[model samples]
Target: MRGRKELEKYWGRPYTDTRDWSIYNERLVRRGEFYLSLDFIDHWTDLVSRMNTGKPGRPFHYPEPFITWMAFIHVFLQMPYRQMEGFTRKLSIFIPSLVSADYTTLFRRIKRLDISLRVDPTILSRNVIIAVDSTGIKVTNRGEWMREKWRVRRGWIKVHAMIDIETNQILGLEVTDESVQDDARCIPLLDQVQQHCGREHTIRRLLADGAYDRNEIFNTLEKRGILSGIKTRTDAATRSTGSPYRAECVRERVRLGGYREWAQDIDYGMRWKAEGVFSSGKRIFGETVRATSKEGMIREVKMKMNCYNMLLTMVK
Candidate 1:
């Protein structure tokens, strides 16, 4: 097919030696059992001082830093709560904060927890190029037979996220039930990106798949002066009633050579970096949620993304 041929040609590119970066990233994790332990201690201790966890009766044994950092350890190691309690106790020599909270207290906080694992935007470059995408996250571990034979609907959550394509850093995330469409969240995801990165930070472009081929998405990008690399649906016209940018995109193809040519010109293939977000998140956090309730599932999946983004910061 012509499409297949075009893709093959487009795939060709030069490679650079990124081994040094990989070695450095590994060193970040390799320094201790708690990878980036001191970084976390410094980060969480600062966070705790500002938090309104409030004065507990008779001064609580746990420092907010200890409880919070240990929970992150829970996610990073995928350790069981009880096991992590013991693990933290043993590792307190490195970060004294780890001993402040026991695993039991940590578990209770985790179950009833509301925390945002945000990347510090102040540390980033002002240049922003965002990409948005959504992926299905399984809510249960049950197999296909359970759904097919029993006519049971499988529980699933959808994770919609926007990321900085250049740095592979996630900027914002939204978790929803399976029924929610991808396009439905594009605007909100952009809002989230702006909130996280700050309104003053300029977004240059947004890349997405055909699922984001909506007039609203195009219009929003146009108003913000952001170039859009969203895939147009096969049957969708270049002149849609709602999208003015569609006209520019059509012109882009004609001015260059063809559809694939324009895509290559703009480096639109970088959209897959958004896909990489889903792949890495699932690989690190997991493919399924262990929570039984909808709220719990949403929180777990959202936190998974948050922690995943935090890991991205470590590589910096």
Candidate 2:
């Protein structure tokens, strides 16, 4: 892959928008107002909030629905607690619920929220092909200036995501520290799909990579009657390991000349869609997490995913 400097020529250095902005100025301005137009976005945040009922003690200042909405804004804007607190404070007059909000309140609400991202209904209506992959998210967002000034390097957290190929929407997600292996996440992601889609939902295919080539992983998919388009590593034990299902996958690749041909035959190249998911995530939300503690790290990543689903729902 080309580094940023090397890729500069491809970006058309002296860039300009070819489209006429004058014709679309009003529409573009209205589009940017989506965030300020709370009523327009309320439907999305309400769905997640309504799932959890309010507590049974002396009442809280803000309802769960309001808490849920504000928390999501934190992720959507990729803002820190202080920035989020200030943002809502400015809007306090427009929204009565924001009058009492503070950074700690927003923090606590997200920490406790039990997040579940549903498969889009249209995607659910038909069979699914899910792509599974993982990527590293850094602990801090340091631009070139900061890196050069401080010579700083930070640790990363791994995000395992399952994307519904057709919808191009994340169906489920898991986050862990950098030490966790990619293979460890495969089964958990599959289980999440089963939970969301139910027995009636047919999972037609599974796409993954060489890291998930273990025996149990293949067998698990076999039991579900899913055809796996996992790119297998070439090895002599290809004949000896696991069940015929696994061996057949390898043999088929060997027979088709090589990995390239096998991929083209089965549309295995679509596995890169999972990679595209990670790239889009990092590009939209920045490639780092702001949380310091383990639990906080997990919660922050999960909130980003929940925000992704909400954005997908709203756009669709």
Candidate 3:
């Protein structure tokens, strides 16, 4: 065993970080440009014309894209609406044709905005594996002060998401109150994955931690013909508790000696991509929701995720 270890060490090459720091740094710098982007202004008139063509109420003075850009700037830069309004008014000083939305307009338009994930077209042509997980974003950032002064409990909302392991793009997202369980979201997330990937694509597998270990989850995946790489509970039994597939999974893990061996066989390490995504999202967007209302908070989270996906594409 000692000789084998020495031979393995001699033959194996330790992986090195070969990333191009300059290009990566450049991409990060470009993120700032999105916050201040004026390219949308070129098509501003046409967008408004189409938007106002047959509308019932008063025609929109500011285009939806411009409103969306303001919203994006707000979330990405963590700037308040009033500050965003000031920023836009400042921009209009240089570009005489620019029309700025005030804080109230910004707030109303952002809440009413319909945000959706912009998935890559290539995902439709290939079989995919997905990792599923959820994380909590604070409902309000006043937790410390509120707790100290008012003795009130500050709550959080859950952001449940599924990502393509190959592309590291979010396939589906569901925003719920923190009371929603991880296992309960699996099927809905799977449905959303299908919606984004379309009828032609196949989900080859799913990877998740033991938080998703449940008979219903296993059976749902089994029916869809997708391999489940969800880690079973430590004391999982081979005996069927309702789902034979779950029993079989437990048996397979037992046969492989332990979780580590099973993980190797299934390449379960890829599940960390979900966690990495959550970390990246939190780092970029912060852990708190800026909106106080439930509806506004939901829209805010969705918009941030949409921006997150856009940022991912930019880096690629």
In terms of lDDT, the best-performing candidate is: 3
Q: What is the TM-score of candidate 3?
A: 0.88
Judged by whole-model lDDT over C-alpha atoms, candidate 1 comes out at: 0.74
lDDT of 1 by residue, 127-172 (tens): 6888888889887878889888888886679888888887777787
lDDT of 2 by residue, 101-129 (tens): 78898887767777766456554646888
Please give each candidate's TM-score: 0.82, 0.79, 0.88
Query: By descending TM-score, how would the candidates be arranged?
Result: 3, 1, 2
User: Model 2 off-target regions past 4 Å?
Assistant: 1-34, 40-56, 95-100, 142-154, 236-238
Output the TM-score of candidate 2: 0.79
| C-alpha lDDT score of every prediction, in listed order | 0.74, 0.74, 0.85
In candidate 1, the residue pairs with backbone N, CA or C atoms under 3 Å apart (3 or more residues apart, or in different chains) clash, namely none
Residue 39, model 1: Cα distance from true site in angstroms: 7.1
Candidate 1 residue 164 C-alpha distance from true site, Å: 0.5
| lDDT sort, best first | 3, 2, 1
Worst 10 residues of 3 by lDDT: 7-16
